[model samples]
Target: MKILIADDDPSSILYLQDMLGEWGYEVEVAVDGNAAAEILRRSDGPLLAILDSMMPGMDGIDVCRGIRQSDTERYVYMIILTSRVESEFIVAAMNAGADDFISKPFNDEEMRVRVRAGRRIVELGEQLRRRASRDALTNIYNRGAIIEILEKELSRQGRSQHAVSILFCDVDNFKAINDTHGHLAGDEVLRVLARRMAATLRPYDSFGRYGGEEMLGVFPDCGLEGALEVAERMRAAVAEAPVKTEFGDIDVTVSIGLATVDKDQTCKLATLLQRADDALYRAKANGKNCITIAH
Candidate 1:
């Protein structure tokens, strides 16, 4: 495991480095709290941090607070090393997001055990996040997950000035199909449509079920014209493919709406979705099985 040691005492920092290194861990040291915080902010970071309670320019508690505040995937197992063992001091460390605690003049075996336990907690947290963010039916992102991803992508693209497009699609006459063929058939159709859309799009492009019989797609680095082409292809594919059921072959068509992100446009995912939805209504108005572009 990779470990970070942050302590104002040079001797303590050296002791940690030597012990952890002998235990087959890669160790990085920070002399004070500010340096530790900077190291945590980097793209590559340590799996755990052993922070001293007293440090200059920001205490270990403040450093822990900052780490918890950032949205980073690398789990920081913070162990606060301090002489203070009062109830209030322990509570304060916990409140500041300390994962574990070690008294000053730490026992080597105890420290190792605590770090191992912290790793388990980090794994559980990751698993829970994945389960919460995924769609149960399609296994693609649900509306909430898609919106979160959209917001992040928008923020990233804003800084980079990259192009991105949104495609809103609906199964044409889906209600009629469900009423005629049964809900089971409707479900199969939705699953098949999702799979087909995923196959057609690039690996980086995101697809999700926006709601019942509706799907949302995000194509990064794609302009309006390219998005329209993609939407047209998807619409044609759906029209051509016939879903087979116990009843018989059921043909389906899809209506699509395309919108591109720009500097002037609102960055909010909901606003982008609304624009795409408006375009989808226009598509339905113009014709049932066609693509419409939103300006």
Candidate 2:
């Protein structure tokens, strides 16, 4: 785990850094509020922070306020280092989004306990976020989370006028599978297809379960040709394998609708998604296991 110590006092910095390091933590340092705030607000910043209450400017309270107000999805657990014991001071710290507090000149044992508590809370928060963002069945991004990712990626690509490709995929004969084998078996097929198709995708591509037996893929900086190639690979990955379930080996295949936004083409997110969906519907109409591209 990483901990950030934001204090202008050299002695305090050295003391915390040395102690935290001894306790198996990587320590990051910032001498002033601006630097501290920048680190804490960054997406990959340390989630555990200890801020001195009386820094030169924009003290710990201000830092907490700024972080809480920022549009970052990362959660930061902040502890305000203060000597004050007044009720008003505690209220102020809590209102500013400090998770906990440690009095200045704190006892060594007290610091260790409080730090561990903060780390546990951070871990719990992360677990909760993962549960909320992931699909319960397939362990892929849930519908809302996947759509959010696609929007963010598209917005990022739009800024650079880079190509963005997407795929809308659905299981072929999924209803028939559920009627013949149990729904549990159908679920197993979905899981198996998700795992295989995900393995075949490029590292940067995003694959998620949009809904039952339907999946969505977002490919940033990938063109139409690349997207179609991936679609074909995904199709083959499912058609070539039999998913082993409690019932038995079950044959499965998928149909895909591939769409792309060229650097020169500008379109709304809904339009692109609908284009892919339309293509996917056409692919299913033409044949069960096939890929179709949207012009």
Candidate 3:
């Protein structure tokens, strides 16, 4: 893990850097509050930070406050160093979002223990977030997470004037497969198909399990034609390959419904989703294993 040490005191910075480096952590240093804040603003910034209570321009408290107030999604395990053992100082640090505190004259053993605690907390948070956002069966984004992504992209398009598109995909005859082959075999088919369709999508595209036997794909900066082409490819990929399950090789097909937002139009996420879903139903009505584009 990478750790940031923000302190104005050169001697203290050197001491912590040397010790932290020896302990197998990549160490980064910041001489004052402004530099520290800049580093924390970066997407690839260190997740663990130790800030000195007193620094020029911005103190550790101010830096901590800024981090808590920022739009960052990741959590930073922050520690505040202070010379005073007063209760008010500890309260101030806690209010400013400091995760832990170490006295200015840091103890070697105490530092190790606190740092270990910080790592544990950060890891636990990451694990919980993954569980919440991921679908257990297909290992793709869950329904809630995909819907949230769609909403966010719609909001972004309003500001950037970029086109966005979505594909609502439903597996054809999936219920019949489950009835004939059993639920376990049906699950294997869903997992295999999820991997295959995900491979067909662009790296920037977001693919997720919308619900049972249904998937969703979000394409950013893509128009109607682009989305339709991708959707056709995805349909072909499913039809061409057989999903190998423990029971047997099961041939499956998918129906896709595509909806796109042009640069000039403003669309709500709910409306966009409804259009794609309606198109999906149309595709089913037209016949299984086909693509329908929502105009």
Give lDDT per model, in order: 0.84, 0.91, 0.91
Error of 2 at 87 (Å): 4.9
How much lDDT does candidate 1 score?
0.84
Model 2, 25-86: lDDT tens digits are 99999999889999998767999999998887689999999999998887999999988989
Model 3 worst lDDT run, 10 consecutive residues: 195-204
* Candidate 1 lDDT tens digits, 1-295: 6788998888887888888888778999998899999998775787678899999988989999999999975567798999998999999999989988999777889998887787777668767777787777777778887877778888877888777899899999999999999998888888777877777887678888888989989988777877877887788778876988776778999999888896444456777888899999999999789988886
lDDT of 3 by residue, 140-237 (tens): 89999889888888998999999999999999999999998999999999998888888888877889999899999999899998898889888988
Which pairs of residues clash in candidate 1, taking residues 3 or more apart in a chain or in different chains? none
Instruction: Give the distance in Å from residue 132's predicted Cα in candidate 3 to where it truly belongs.
Output: 2.1
Q: How much is the lDDT of residue 35 in candidate 3? A: 97
TM-score of 3: 0.82
- Per-residue error for 230 in candidate 2, Å, reads 4.9
